[model samples]
Target: MLFLVAALLLLGVAMGSVAHAPLPVSLVAAAVIGVWLVVFTVRERHSRRHSS
Candidate 1:
């Protein structure tokens, strides 16, 4: 609930900033965020598997 709202807010802010950013900067930022999400997903999966 709160987390979802916060995530949505952050996403909106990020998107807004990205829209104003230069193309190259936006691309790099997106790549970094993508990598971060991948890493976060992998870690969460690993943690869950180990916990279970």
Candidate 2:
């Protein structure tokens, strides 16, 4: 999960630098991170509930 987020962040940086469009790159990265957080949080909650 961490790896995925890290990869997306790196990709975002690369794309922004290469394309010279920080705004779009930032928006994409923000969306990806937001979705990832929601999914990760839900999975963690489910796991914790099952464990107990």
Candidate 3:
């Protein structure tokens, strides 16, 4: 999870620098991170419920 966030952030920065389009790259990265976080949280909750 942390790795994914870091990778996306780095990719965003690299893209922004190369493309000179920080807004789009940053928005994409933010959306990806948000989706990832939501999925992770949901999966964690499901696993905990099943385990218990």
Candidate 4:
């Protein structure tokens, strides 16, 4: 999740610098990463509660 977020940020910057166009791909990538992070965090919290 962290990797995805970092990658998306980097890609967005690169695209912005090189192409100077709107970064649709980077926006989608960031959204995907954000969703994955939220879902994983929720699942981890639930698992910890049950295990304890």
Instruction: Give the count of colliding residue pairs in each prediction.
Output: 0, 0, 0, 0
Tell me the lDDT of candidate 2. 0.88
Error of 1 at 27 (Å): 0.3
> Candidate 1 local accuracy as lDDT?
0.95
Please, what is the TM-score per model? 0.70, 0.58, 0.60, 0.58
Highest TM-score scorer: 1
Top lDDT prediction, candidate number: 1
Q: Candidate 4 overall Cα lDDT vs. reference?
A: 0.85
Model 4 lDDT tens row, 1-52: 9999999999898767656545796677679989999999999999999999
Please give the CA lDDT of all the candidate structures.
Answer: 0.95, 0.88, 0.87, 0.85
Better of 2 and 4 by TM-score: 4
lDDT of 1 by residue, 1-52 (tens): 9999999999999889988999999888889989999999999999999999
Please give the TM-score that candidate 3 achieves against the real structure: 0.60
Which portions of model 1 show Cα errors greater than 4 Å?
1-12
Error of 2 at 8 (Å): 20
lDDT of candidate 3 over 1-52, digit per residue (tens)? 9999999999898866757656787788779989999999999999999999
Two-way lDDT contest, 2 vs 4, winner? 2
The candidates, ranked best first by TM-score, are 1, 3, 4, 2
Q: Give the range where candidate 1 is weakest over 10 consecutive residues by summed lDDT.
A: 24-33
